[model samples]
Target chain A: MLDSERLATDSKPNILLKGTKEGLLLLLNEVVSFESLLEDLSTLIHGEKKSLFEGPDLKISVDYGERVFAASEIREILDCLAKRENLILREWGPSTAAKLSLFNSSRKFGPQTLLKGTVRAGQRPVFEGDVVVIGDVNPGAEIVASGDIYVLGRLRGIAHAGFLGDWSAIIAAAEFAPMQLRIADIVSRAPERDGKPLRTFMEFAYLKEDSMAVDKLDSLHAWTAMARQSS
Target chain B: MGTAIVVTSGKGGVGKTTSTANIGTALALLGKSVCLLDADIGLRNLDVVLGLENRIIYDIIDVISKDCKLEQALIRDKRFEHLTLLPAAQTKDKSILSPETVKELVGALKELHDFVIIDCPAGIELGFQMAVSGADRAIVVTTPETPAVRDADRVIGLLEKEGIRNPHLVVNRIRPQMVKRGEMLDIDEIVQVLAIDLLGIVPDDETIIKNANKGEPTVMKPDSKASLAYRNIARRILGESVPLLSFEEAPGFWGKMKKVFGAK
Candidate 1:
């Protein structure tokens, strides 16, 4: 019965597993108490036995072995291991079956994605790489980084992507409102806080013709390609 | 050593120039060597405020460009023996004074005077940067309003980023009676948000206007609250800890009856 819950079809520890259309969901499993379980699990994760918290962000679904512990304890152990490795844990909860829908559902393969959390007042997001946040960036928040930026929500805060002078950088969000936007050296600010709202499916923003431009996200690939070419 | 103090506010028209001019005159009247450098560039007014507009044979640009010597560009204050003015060039804006050039000017002036005061332009432009760049310390001036304090916080952040060692706050145009009623942003509130040291609190004083018109600074007056406040700031710059002065309404007779009767 335990092995049934344990989806260790591959030589992965199966601590964190989620089936994605792109690839097998895997995560670093470091909290297993038994030395042998840690070793076996480590081998399964990398195919070559190694310690946890190494490599890039991986999507993982927990394979509950026959010997089960409290759900909360598992979360806590994962959180502790993440903290030790300077990693941010994005949880798709294990308790409720609603979250399981996300576990079983197919997620699109992407280099990365923008988060959807609200950018509240006084909060800031400054990343060194590409960022795509799926939520609204509120007023008084700031986003500064050295790569491309995309916001699937309102880009109201001060967003400065490509601060290190990558002119090909872009900032696209669902809504086209932002207090100030900067791609490379070009800067633009929403003149009036009271701007018309956009109820749209998707939007794209990037440095175009020496300034910032907004367009449909579906049409992003062409210009983004051009942006890279011109640079 | 001479003190180079930059009076700045991130927002415009918060009495930065007025405070700098008055305090420069005040410190000079106390017999300290003082130089007031107006970094406002195109909007120069320290000369006008000091009533020395007619004596501008050479400007700060002349001194920096070495077109004329620093001594010739310096306008001597008529009233104070030790005070001098470095008027901003009428044609040039703040961009003319690069950070390196500004540091050189102030560093040179610091050797010759007891206080080298700079009048900063509003906002974080090249002028504001120049005004504060050569400062040994900074005096962040703010009014009892929201925009002023918010901008002041921005200035504080920039100053801290530039590695300015000591930054002090000066609460200007405070209406204490309103503060007592929660009608105004009190000194404590502004200080808390900026998280800086408080040098002094200046109340709204009518005599200040009269003094400005007469080309006199309140710092020379003994009993004036504004004068006392400036003096306190001066002493603080001199490495002395001074207590803040509060303006108490005349505690005498008719004041009480007027309050009780709600009289104007």
Candidate 2:
């Protein structure tokens, strides 16, 4: 926890800031009026907003804490919070802090999945963890996982494997035709519906590889064995 | 858990608005309170397709800008008592509508309606985003032609980008004979290329135009080929497992003649 991130609740279901490993402290309380909460947070942060963090990076994840929020309302809040990240990031991660520290240069979290299902046009799934499938990701379908992703099916829709920007994550699909795939801060688009497809069941994608490489899944048995043995 | 569907396509004149009007009406006939909002703004045509154009005294723009109450802007259809139309403004006031506004409107409307069917425009713009802003899912409508299908694929990608999960695909204007004769794109092929879940496939029928002219959406047109298909789609949206309707029209003249005349 960062020294600057203090915990407070006002003894009510209101906005409270708690900084975690992911960075910007967010205490989401839907009971309080959103406008009043925003006004209060802005006022509280006004004095120390600049010196709040040493680096220009942060992320805010508002958990509704079991409140049933309209999806549109959620979208609105997220869009606004993301803009603040562009101007000044309040979240702090080990990698982010490591980048600023001249000690080392490496990332972690490589365990991921690639799923392939015939995601029908109107079907959508938001996976905040690792996901893997072996079916066609249909058009109009959505996949938003916060971990890693691998699809044995044609990816022609929208997929965001590391939506929260877990930099160690990566995604690899068999045909790789998604309209968009957001892994960490890097987002790659198919550009068009037509593209050359690979027919390999084995492909390895990770931050170490830096690019998606198509191959036989079994070819990386040694890595799998090592990964399994490490645990 | 109610479904929010934005009927959209990349190519114009592919019957997106028509399909939306018909499907919403048909779904309402199934006993769901359906709110069909025209998100096309400047080029709104859903009212015309549903024959509710004259009934619109107020539009979504009116409700948002506080010119009129939301209930007043909602034009209830006499034909299907459960159906209502939040018509698009004929004037240019709706041009400045934002995503948040669209979302809030959808939320307020959804409480009163079971299914909120937004008729999206042909291109990706603020209007289109506004329509999809509150969508939990969607149905991308497309014709069986190359350009339409290609555009559908692109639109599907866009939906994914916008974080719309559970998007169903509807193939409109499909000519089975053309597909069987190797002259048109087939269902499996398009599905393979686009790689999404199939919702309902609608056939190309001449009644579509006639229905549009009468402002009687085809989904409710008793025995029309397209109407039946839209009905099946509504059932699917209601979570019923209806068998996929076959568009493989019985082989044409020469082939049928060959069978009758004992010729190969």
Quality of candidate 1 docking, DockQ: 0.04
Best by DockQ: 2
Candidate 1 global CA lDDT score? 0.72
Which ranges of candidate 1 are over 4 A from the true structure?
A: A1-231, B92-96, B255-264
Q: How big is the positional error of residue B148 in model 2, measured in Å on the Cα after superposition? A: 2.8
Docking quality level of the chain pair in candidate 1: incorrect
What shift in Å separates residue B197 of candidate 2 from its native position after superposition?
A: 1.4
lDDT (0 to 1) per candidate? 0.72, 0.72
Which numbered prediction scores highest in lDDT against the true structure? 2
**Tens digits of lDDT, candidate 2, B146-175:** 678767866776788899756788988888
TM-score of each: 0.56, 0.56
How would you encode candidate 1's per-residue C-alpha lDDT over A1-231 as one tens digit per residue? 235544564455435544443333344344455444544444454454333445665434443334455667566556543543433444434343333444434322224545655554455667777888866666566887777777766665688888888776677776666778888888987666443443456665677678777777888777745643453
| Separate DockQ for every predicted complex | 0.04, 0.05
TM-score of 2: 0.56
